[model samples]
Target: MNAPPEDDLSLGQPNVPATYFKDQRVTCEKDLYKSLPPLINGKAGYQSLLPDHTLVDTSNHADPNSEKGAKIRPDLGHYEHGVVSEEHPTMLDLIILAYEVKKARKEDIVNDTMKCTKPLPHDDCQAPYENTCQTSTITRGQLANYATQICRRQHRTHFYMVFIFHPFIRFIRWDRAGAIVTKRINYVEDCTPLVRFLYLFGRLDRAGKGFDPTVQPASQAEAEEAKKYLKRWEPKLERTVFKMDVPAANGKMRQFLVWGSLADPESPLGRTTRGYPAVEVIDGVVSAKPVFLKEQWRSVAVRPEVETLKELNEHGVLHVPTLLCGGDLPGQETKTHEISIGNWRVGHKRIDKRIHTRFVVAEVGQPLENFPSSKVMLGAIYNAFQGHDQAYNKCKIWHRDISGGNILILDNNKGLLSDWDLAREEADLDNGARAHERTGTWPFMSVGLLQQPNKQHTTRDDLESFFWVILYYGLHYLPHTHRDSLDHMMKEIFDQYDFAERDGMARGGNNKDALVRRGRYLGSRRSQQFSFIGCQPLTEFLFDCLDLLGKWDFRYDPTIQSWEEDGYIPASHAEMEPLWRQALQSPLWPVADRAVDQVRLSKRLDFIVRGERPERKGSKRSDPHDSIQDDEDDDDECSPRKRRKTCHGSEAAHL
Candidate 1:
């Protein structure tokens, strides 16, 4: 992650300016003719065979009656008036006949014939029959033509020819019998290895069952409601799709050629249990639902946008993609032009009717297996944070879901943060709706996210989820067991890990010792360990991340008491300089290293507060909401035994 060597030829020079930090645009069509060389033509002429078996062009303008002219003529008196005659000829006739034969041989020479096979060397093989020997002595050009002729004779059966034009050229046979073209395309560019990995893993469309309108037929009332909602949201959705392209990794063709709609029962998106009838296209058109559910939450609480904004402000920081469009209404068209590669599917097969509503395509540079474990995979996670951080700061957007599935690794090995279905713009950190339901993958949910009235997701929660993702990559499993049932998982997370109490302990303040007790238990040596468990460094990193969440601290300006507090302190700014430098250097390393630094700084700040002179007068009054109070800790807690254990070692590992 260090700056690439200055003299590296492959990297060349950085083209983007420092001030214009945005997604880089790649010309999708540039890879079409990368490897083919120019065509060239050879000489055109004929040759004659002499009496000595040497071949030459024998033509002379001055020797009209001589042997050379006789060879070129069609008739002769001794050889039937310059036409070489085989019977009743004199010595002059014999010479003219031989010359004419040589001239006839010369007229038969071809310039571009392919030699199918070389004659066996005199020492390598027994002498062949005269006729066979003559046939074997063919040119390379003659050979090629002969082989092509043989192929046409034997294999000219029916088959469709597919021509793909791109990074590479390929001719494929579609139907061997019918001779119909099924698909012809050029090599794709801009696709990264991660995208290819996901494709090989399987297209997202195959994740679940086909749509069943018979089972979940829309009620008359619901259908009416949907129609009304669509009318209000359609224009905004169109504008969003037209404004930006979904970042994709496919480079073969700039525009996608979609054949159907997500709303169609037969379409990939409509067949999912939690399906959205929206279609998203990278470079072409996909017609379906306009907005999908913002989160996987079970209930409707606060507006989805409010939660999206809050998360972006706190967790996304700066790398959120602009929200082209989002909402619950169906039947609106949403399009994205940004090309990316990733898999998208909706619903768990076990619980809901499998609906394959989500679709994602990305450009991963090479095959997925070729990616070095730590460099490409882990690097992607790190870069996502950088981009997410940028978007949060610059565009005031937050990405509530920052999972492996949502992150796309581009062909250039850079991670692109995508899936803005749950993104939102924010003006301030503290001003947003309170969502009361849990959403996002269960394995990465923050401890607080598991509690009831699940609407309290924050940047800290996102950080905690990010920790889970890193753990997933390193350990290949969640830190704790998932419940047997989704309901159980939700309950365990919402009720057991009290965010408020853990927050106090994180700040180095006293709380119901239960919070610390839980942390020790989870991180303790006595806990059941799995084979995929990460090494100490990784575990320690996870612990540090948890500590940061407990402390509610951001890496930037750690002196700020709360995210809402706004002031630029020169001293705090100086302290942040090194952190920023570190971030720039390792743009793609997980935030673990930096998260640890933030935790350490938070602890130091707490120490300084405790060590301050009590006699100092007129210190600014601490905001009541910002103050950590030991008395306010909740005593109500859920028993761990009530939770069903779902982690069955590495069986659930996904790359």
Candidate 2:
């Protein structure tokens, strides 16, 4: 450890003058609060070092009010000075660090997690080692949970965690790229390292403190200006207003005022897409018309959404959200990928590096599920399909992530395909690269892609995703008859996954694959199908669409392939192209443009679709077909949905 604060030697910490930590005696995890608070609060060094902050121990915190899972309480937190309340529980702004403590030594706690990113032999995957020590596994999970909770509660670029084991301390810095853990420091003999770290943490500015600088409080006037055109969502707190600066169409920095409460996902990781209906601030004047503003984190290697949107606009792709402006937020990217603690380098299979990104679209539309009538929903979906087709055929852009959330309905009820962050150009991605990273939303991702984790994303996968999006909204609103078994069906097909022993990732494609393989997309009886529903036209349209393309979902068993005698053809854009055509000529249209019944949607979403989310939905049995299944590529008889090369694995975190 470094010398005590009185060492008077210049040490390379963030802040200049060195401050000392109290020599508080502690034995185990329980004693950390009692012994350490003095170093942060009044008596020890709190006032002199971090006058504006206080360390609050909330290890047992429970928020009964939050419907969004148990508020994961960090053992201790460095927060802006104040008493913690249910409303401002974790201090959403100005967070210094989140701390977790394990009674065990640093080795026991840290070694619990496997270095999946290490350059290890493919056959010798480290995943099985995670089960070697049960306690260490639990501790690793807890540490990741704490880090994730902190990231969710606060809008931040990255955050820090102080993992303590009495004498030993490890500093973990977390970003979208993953985590960078420092070697352990023994703080029992000399407390300077912990003291100096905390002192400098308080000294750093807002960004240095890990808050997102792109977000700032909106003025009362700006908030009022945005409220006129923007719709609102009820957030945990009385909605806070904020203004974000993004690159405008004119190549100038412009401000957009967001009135609605920016919603955080249940898990504060991944794209964490924060979207809003915003109005522009131009020359001290707010625009009368509103636009859509979306902010999300995306891989640096992935093509920018703006470039794809501009490409679509240039090729005159139909039904796509019109690109106005916006690009990668300069100088705002993850810092964790650069950090590798010897054995743990960042993995390239998932996200290598992520950058904060912002963009605006001219159309301010409602979500796809909010369609007033069945025909409108069909039209919107049909329009989105056309947009996808033109983008693929004309511009050679593949929109990888197709979900109910990504489709929107305009005032005229035409569907607009949005959320192109994961879209890629065919030229740039001949193999549909980053299969693990930018693959679309979970429920809607093609079963083929989900089944074969390393599968290169293909147009066929996108087409399958399109079908799921339609079925998702259809099952929710079209009044399907499979009531008693709806919950089980949804859970199995959409949520079920088996941990691929090959890569150690949850790949839930068996049921979805079985759904197609058995021709059981719908049930057997009339009572099992969506018959005599209010949205009969929509139901009919869906069946027609499914029959045309879903037939191609046949399992491609290469062992029994015919050399032209069977006349088998792999799935292609030709089969899916008809859905868009049928949608255009679709005689049935909704009686009127209608908004979604939020209450109804919410209830069914939890019940039928998510199966009310059990303590854990009973896992589907592992498939004997662990071999990379194929969907049969037209040109190259490759594995399902054109599998990408095997994974180093991807995503938020596995631990």
Index of the highest-TM-score prediction: 2
Each prediction's number of clashing residue pairs = 94, 12
Write candidate 2's Cα lDDT for 1-655 as tens digits.
1233555433443332232323455566777767667656656423535667777776766433332343566777777766566454554343477777776573345443445444422222344433336776777778776665556545678788888876678887777656666656777666677767776666678787677787887888877776665543323334556788897767667788875323333233455456666788876588878777877676666677888889899988999888788988878887655553334542323335678888888986665656777677777887888888889889888888777766778878788888787676786666645444426566777877786666677778888877777776666555556544555666676667666576555576677666555547574223244442455555665666566554564434555455245544456677766656665565655466354433344556666766785234111111110112121111111122221111111110000
lDDT of model 1, residue 468: 53
Residue 539 miss distance in model 1 (angstroms) = 4.4
TM-score, cand. 1 = 0.31
176-214: candidate 1 lDDT, tens digit per residue: 111111121222333222122212222112111111111
Candidate 1: residue 417 Cα off by (Å)? 2.2
Give TM-scores for every candidate, taking all chains together and pairing residue i with residue i.
0.31, 0.78
- Candidate 2, which segments miss by more than 4 Å at Cα? 1-30, 45-47, 59-67, 82-90, 103-108, 112-132, 234-236, 249-251, 259-269, 341-351, 431-438, 508-510, 513-517, 521-536, 550-655
Off by over 4 Å in 1: 1-255, 258-371, 427-437, 477-517, 520-540, 553-655
lDDT of 1 at 301: 21
